[model samples]
Target: MKLGRHSPAPKRQKCDHWSPCPPGNFAYRILSGGGKERTATICFEDEQLVGEPGSGINIAIVNYKTGEFSSTNFFHMWAHDHSKQMMDFIRSAPKGTLLLMATQDDGSTRLKDYAKELVENLGSKEIKNIKFRSSWVFIAAKGFNLPDNIQREKINHSDQTKNRYKGWPAEIQIEGCIPRNLM
Candidate 1:
């Protein structure tokens, strides 16, 4: 439920399986990239880091540069409820607050729709720089075929091979300012 920056998550603290902190507490972290600091939201669950950025399942993207984030859960159904909290969080942000959000791609436009919905709710008054990130796939259609040279160079089947990931979130979106522009 926290939306603003706080002390970095205690990394030295043991969180796997058993720890002193309460269960479901987000462990704040600082990720350094290109001499800039980016705060990341992390939580330990099932004896593992369940909500670290760029890793784990159903993770919420956190920016060290901008103190904005969303309530995320591993389950989509559960995340829907958490997202309501996130919606409220966004509303609570003061004017000109640099807000950011990243959503999972469930093969549907729900995430995009929700982001648009948030913007629409502002009634064209509130302006925020929202950056987004999600997974994309390049595929050949039924009638389409790649040229031999291009196929040999671009057709990386191993990179495209994955059955387990398909079941994972199809998209992961992050909107907000980081240390730099990642467009």
Candidate 2:
């Protein structure tokens, strides 16, 4: 009986999640790169912390307790020897920090084994399998452990026979609600 423009349809959860997270949880979304148009993206608690197009690795650090981002940075792994620096950055994150990573283009050409090993310590099972132009995304907690049921990582490799783009693979994405009480 009362309405000019209907109250905008019930707002969707952050990052367009299909459903709202429970009261004590936060939502997040991670999208990997795919060609020139599809770049990488990272969303935490309904806020986009990183979404730039380039060729390398994108990283975001979040304070688990505060629910705020502490830093956002990327490395050019395709054309530069930034693996050492990337490793150093990862090592610096303290306990209770949430680390999110996504690939924009080629993330393994310049990535050394040391860097991959470091990521593995954080529970990434696919870091070693990444190949040229592979789309990858990962989330890990520095000190605490994420629930085993949560989706922690994903990857898509560029296959000449079935790539979505002429020279790039299709993008991959992962979204989930993380419990805020994670210690």
Candidate 3:
């Protein structure tokens, strides 16, 4: 019989990243909703800030300097007049705040043009392209800009012919290390 020593498993980094983040950096992960059973989630600094399955949008706010989360909210846009409210919530974020957003179901059904513009201002390039039940996730900074190299936004559209689940698209996720706010 051959005897071999067992090795310990590698430690998991924040947000289950492939590797540990560099010093003075924050780790984050954002996942868009898939089918009815899979919900969207947002994680930062090793904590799950938001996770819920429903129609509309999920939002989380985090303090950039302290690496602390402040709030989580959901806005139902499919059949509600909540676009203005959501826009206000986004505008309320203060400087140095990190905004994480994900869509659970139909995020663009009732989304207005102004709201899309606001998301665009936050560096989102795919907001205008979201369709019915499209899976989308985004991370944006309020006052500063995230490095261009960092992964900040991702989207997957629901196509009947190529849907991963019945009437829904496959889930999409973005995970990476964001440098700590130095300014």
TM-scores of the models, in the order given: 0.28, 0.92, 0.94
Give the C-alpha lDDT of model 1.
Answer: 0.28
Q: Per-residue lDDT tens digits of candidate 2, residues 46-160?
A: 8899897756889999999989999988988877889999998898888999999999988999899989999999999999999988889999999999999999999988584
Q: Which ten residues in a row have the lowest lDDT in candidate 2?
A: 158-167
Query: Model 1, which residues run further than 4 Å from truth?
Result: 1-80, 104-116, 120-164, 169-183
State residue 33's C-alpha deviation in candidate 1, in Å: 18
lDDT of each: 0.28, 0.90, 0.88
Q: List the residue pairs that clash in candidate 2.
A: none
Give the per-residue lDDT digits (tens) of candidate 1, residues 92-134.
5544223222222321222344643664353312112222212
Where is model 2 more than 4 Å wrong at Cα? 1-10
Candidate 3 lDDT by residue in tens digits, 14-112? 899889999999999999888888999999999998875656889999999899998888888888768888889999889999999999978988899
lDDT score at residue 95, model 3, on the 0-100 scale = 91
lDDT of 3 at 175: 89
Predicted structure with the largest TM-score when compared to the true one: 3
For residue 68, what is the lDDT in candidate 3? 93
Task: Determine which window of 10 residues in candidate 3 has minimal summed lDDT.
Answer: 157-166
- Candidate 3 achieves a global lDDT of 0.88
